[model samples]
Target: MSGSEDLLELAVETAREAGRMLVDKRPVDGPDVVQTKSSPTDVVTQMDRAAERLIVERIRAARPDDAFLGEEGGTSAGVSGVRWVIDPIDGTVNYLYDLPDWAVSIAAEVDGVAVAGVVEMPRRGETCTALRGGGALLRSATGARDLQVNAAVPLGQALVATGFGYAAERRARQAEVLTGVLPRVRDIRRGGSCCVDMCSLAAGRVDAYYERGVQAWDVAAGSLIVEEAGGLVGGLHGAPAGPEITIAAGPGTFEALHDLLAPLDPARD
Candidate 1:
């Protein structure tokens, strides 16, 4: 089996390469739309496909036997038991609007478990990385520093971040859940990017994050980072973080937020 450090190195390098490609190719007016998925507003751009291709190609060149699960390219089975989960652009809306919350996310799984992860935000000039047991860190022009979630913040004082789905029905449900969550917390932020939101939690930029309709590629890297940074990342009903829901936060805030969200049925749509 390949070591976690080896996988992390590849994840970080590929993420950085994809990030640079995305930044250089992003047009001033935004990328050309390829097609829509779950909704008309849930768009996929040419850059999204191109970036996924680049990342898959680079990783394949280094380890041809490894499998892949990409947001844009979908999945390809392999025999190596190491799979790369990738989101070429985690915040497509922000990237399209020239916002700074977009990122390239990559996580390497060994035998169906994430062991290494990377999230690269080119616009923010930041890269977050983690190994399953090693811990998480943020790297930028300034330097590299270990990351940690803000300690056990009370639920009411927690600055929470969350995202909504593209479908109107889902959005409405999410909004309904928010009506209950907003008044209880310090404030709510809709960053429109799961990886960015999770990275923010790891970096102490947000006290917690939860979203109802995220995919594996969206949270794979960010969740690992949060876990390594001393935060809990999970779903409702004692489930692992998946489409049903994903929530991340420090100690006290995690349980409080979970209990609060559970009663609200944030997963319902």
Candidate 2:
């Protein structure tokens, strides 16, 4: 059986390889088959499927007994007591428009807990990796640096990052939640990539992050990165982060934001 550190290495390597494939497959003029899911604004491309295939292929080769739950591909069972949660093109809209926020995310879960995660943002020219209890690290053109959330920033002056859902109604309700939470913070940033936004929080590039109706693949990798970086991850109202909502922040900032937005939680609303 592979150890957590080994699994972490495998996750990072696979994510980076998939990221390079995505970058090469990216179109200069227009992406092929710009498809939509859930809403018109939500997008996907041929590259998304291809990248997922590559990741699944590689992971299967390494750990044939492990399970998989991919954004592009549905769940597949295995007997290895491990499951891989992956998002081939995390920010497909950004990738379609040739923006820099898109990423390839992969996370490994042992039993039911995330033990390793990797997010490779080719356009951003950085890769983030985290191992449970080991900590998170960011690698770029310069070098690698340990990640840590900014605990010093107070709620009023915090620069929070976030993403929206695919449904118009969800987006509308999210907008309402934002307005309520926005005035209490320094400002807002909508990067269109949940994986990137959460990694930014891990790197302390942003003070916090929150989103609703996110799937397991969406936050599986990024949320682990945040937790390993000394940040907090949970639902809007002390519940655990799941499909409902994902809220991440530094120690003090986490408490403040959760309190401010708990009322906006869709499950409760």
Clash count per candidate: 0, 0
Model 1 bad stretches (over 4 Å): none
Relative to the true structure, candidate 1 reaches a TM of 0.98
Query: 30-107 in candidate 2: lDDT tens per residue?
Result: 578657888877777889888999999999999999999999864799999999999998888888888899999999
Best by lDDT: 1
Give each model's whole-structure lDDT. 0.94, 0.88
Q: List the residue pairs that clash in candidate 2.
A: none
lDDT of 1: 0.94
Q: Lowest summed-lDDT stretch of 10 residues in model 2?
A: 260-269
Say which candidate scores most in TM-score.
1
lDDT at 224 for candidate 1? Answer: 95
